[model samples]
Target: MKLQKAPQAAPELVHLEALLGKASVTPLDAGCQPYLAERLEELGFIVERLPCQGVDNLIARRPGVPSLAFAGHTDVVPAGQHWQVPPFQLSELGGYLYGRGIADMKGGIAAFLVAVERALATGHELPGLMLLLTSDEEGEAEFGSRVMAQHLKTQGLLPPWVLVGEPTARSHSGDTLRVGRRGAVSGTLRLSGRAGHVAYLPPTANLLHRALALGQQLAALEWDSGAPDFPGTVLHVTGLEHGDWLDNVTPSSATLRFNLRYSHKTSKDAIDQRIRALVPGDLDFQLDWDRPCEPYFSLFGEAQPNFLTRVERAVFKGLGQFPVLSTAGGASDGRFFSALGCEVIELGLPNASIHQANERVEKGEYLRLIDIYQALLESL
Candidate 1:
């Protein structure tokens, strides 16, 4: 594919182009972390590499009393079909930079790095600044920031303030900031019933019918009206399956999978109990649950007043617009840090095309994001 070069791009855009050039798909760093580690080391950060079960994690810290931390992922979802340019290569068209991870992340990562570099060049005192990057965040997250957070907790290195570089902006680069995220709980349900000929099996004994009915009941459930910072709890039946392929035979078993994105107004325990209660008494069934994250609000305890104000002020200064505090998104690595008592906020480029074909972000937005991040660091 012929790529159109970015005309006189800034250092951050150049860096982001380099990052997008590497194909670090989910669960694979593809040298992205190593490259970042080298750059960070040159900037006087004490870089630590923590590799867990094939996933790469990096913690780069500047020696000082820790005040702020930046968190992000190096991994991106697979570049699926349909692209005007190579998915792994950075392409410029119509004043936009196209790549797989540019908007979803890598763009944010590059912006932060350049922001740090520029801030340090100006002799800015960013005492106790840290950057946390992981390769497993786009995957199962079994061995990424979750492990890093645990390690930081043990070493008493967890920062009080965390800024996650997730693509949170709705309209422009700094229009919205994610003050919190909704929690997710996913479940796989298996129902067992006696297999029989279609003519002999009654409606009560049909596993498929039972599965569909249960799915409807679960979907129709209304959990809550939600709080001011979050939306209402919603459930989605992701998958349903049965073993039998023959049309005339009733399947002996059926399986249903579902997920719930709930707000802070509800607890995981409450969702779990409510789901269990919905199961019929006579059905032979089993339910397995996976709680990936819990909802968190941006409350800094005793530090709330100064820390949040600084962030908001920096954003406004950089973008010429005050950002709206939002809590409307799926779970992210920020949830882990928030759970560990850090006041977490997510800020980055616009997210309109993330995880979609031909993903791209405006070059201007990318450049401005660097200023916003730099301003944030300087404010600290």
Candidate 2:
């Protein structure tokens, strides 16, 4: 079979920008949810909607065998203040597209979709291709991709490979790929305390002071020196709340919530045990945690050779160098897919203004990502 030279840029990428012009806030809403669904159907793929709590997700498949899935989220992080252009509307100033989800993900989805369409038009058939769009990736994601993944598993339709289109580009917005991510464990801690007057504290330690001490101990307790794929296990006192801070009265109760970005080197139970070991024996404290997902390594012997080569070719063609292969940073939905034993890797337009005010992407980089996606499809 003859392979046609890859296009310098996907022309359809711009049309993709227009399609996602309707933006959804957190979970899926009427404005963007239905709009995305219609667009996917128009692309000639069989689509499924797995209703997620309040949000909805889209799963479109071009049927065959041993599938390759391109997964991403459509709902954007709240567009915070810091915009010279409207966050929802597209602006082409300085050759960059400024919008809420432009870089973090909307650009990713557009590029992948255009690649799929281009491959189809050029008679470049894939084993099977799927575009999985969820609305709750930036939210709790309690009911979005997790739900669809479960359904696919039950139906024996989970794809063999997954490419999560999370922007991993550093400095600029191209040439980065993330193949591994650390795990996340989050919960609240509350230590019960007895009320007492500040001036008349007698035989007991003040509840507020005890709680503060416990928090200090928890934070100071070393989690791990550091791990191979993830940074050292560390704890952050994200939220500290007290019912009262009065001068005369001691607090009766206090609560705090913290998160742990951990690695596969340790289990949640082990981390919990470490926390328990750091607390005072007299204080009554509660620890609650849920293992959202464990980290996975996708770079291995045989498969990685082909995948990485294709990825690097596209990266070099678009952004001029192999991006830094670093894993000590933000978590991704790709981490979840990797844990499920699929070959998961993420590469997309540069991540310049992700999860920040007026997230933007270089329009040129967006099209470049499409070329990369198409190249990956051909090489894979």
Candidate 3:
């Protein structure tokens, strides 16, 4: 790829470059949120800093009806060893901006801000508009968008629609738009048995042997045939643990940790019941469940045609491209809004370099995203 200097530094890149200079790796704001808050305040937004635990969140709102919220995270994953350019320093290489979070997020945030800036400058009337930013999205995420969502709900300020800049596009900036996400549920299975020497005959116990059989049963059990809008509910045994290995002794207990990414067709209780049924009657066991995100689709079944139609039109007008509406991806903050009865969609730069070494996004795509966001904001 031949590198070319961009015509000039676009306003959005100026902001992104400033953000990329900050060392705000996951769970740390690195003063990025405060910097953004100041800029938003200057744009006539009511900015509020909401800090939960060590994670910083910022909510900036403008008065109007029919609310539209733009959500993004300022955090970037830790940069691994290989990088032609410093991960924290924004550099243009091969007409692409190289930096962590540029593709995964910060670029999206910068674009949205620029969109708002241009819209206001053009004297365009915007409906209730807001930005929800968190530093916890790339980390444990318990205190980030999750906390902000709860707070918004309490204040009766939850937006009717939300746009999350989560790098959903594949081949091009507007090629893919994530309209839904799968839910993730995890469980730990503890199987117990009497401990005894393997060589001794009196009272021998083999928890590993029993566990293997139970695991096979669970693995073979059919969860669900994927629905049209979502993939099948699948489960995988992520880890297996047992006591120290000994030539002549059998471990007394075994533990298996399994996780499942499921759709709305299944429930935690239903999955729990299936596991209980698969357990052998003679074995003593316990199953514990933890659910992080719930499945949601904004344009599935008898869903909102008007809202999605507007979004489609905006994409066409902004990028001269028709985006593919999809639900294929891991969990994101979009789920929180979906749970709050708000329509959520994710759109951003191509994700080929997201979370990878020398992560970068096309400078052209970054500019196009700002235009897309601006058009989407106008349509809303």
| RMSD of each candidate relative to the true structure | 3.0, 5.8, 2.6
Model 2: lowest-lDDT 10 consecutive positions? 1-10
Task: Supply the global lDDT for candidate 2.
Answer: 0.72
Report the number of clashing residue pairs per model: 0, 2, 0
lDDT of 3 at 326: 86
Q: Between prediction 1 and prediction 2, which has the larger TM-score?
A: 1
Candidate 2: residue 214 lDDT (0-100): 71
Q: TM-score for each prediction? A: 0.88, 0.83, 0.92
State in Å the error of residue 205, model 3: 6.4
Off by over 4 Å in 1: 1-3, 7-10, 193-217, 237-256, 280-282, 302-305
Q: Report lDDT (Cα) of residue 182, candidate 1.
A: 84
Off by over 4 Å in 3: 1-9, 197-205, 300-305
What do the candidate models score in CA lDDT, each in turn? 0.88, 0.72, 0.84
Q: In model 1, which range of ten residues has the least summed lDDT?
A: 5-14
Off by over 4 Å in 2: 1-10, 29-44, 80-86, 171-173, 196-209, 238-257, 289-306, 356-358
> Model 1 TM-score?
0.88
lDDT of 3 by residue, 1-380 (tens): 44443334666777888788898998998989999999998988889999999999999999876478999999999998888777887888877888888988998998889999988888876757999999999888889988998999999999888889999988777788888878888989999877777667353247887777777777777877666766888989888898788877778899988899888778778888988888878889988987567788785325544666767777888778798988898889888888888888898989999999989998888888888888877766
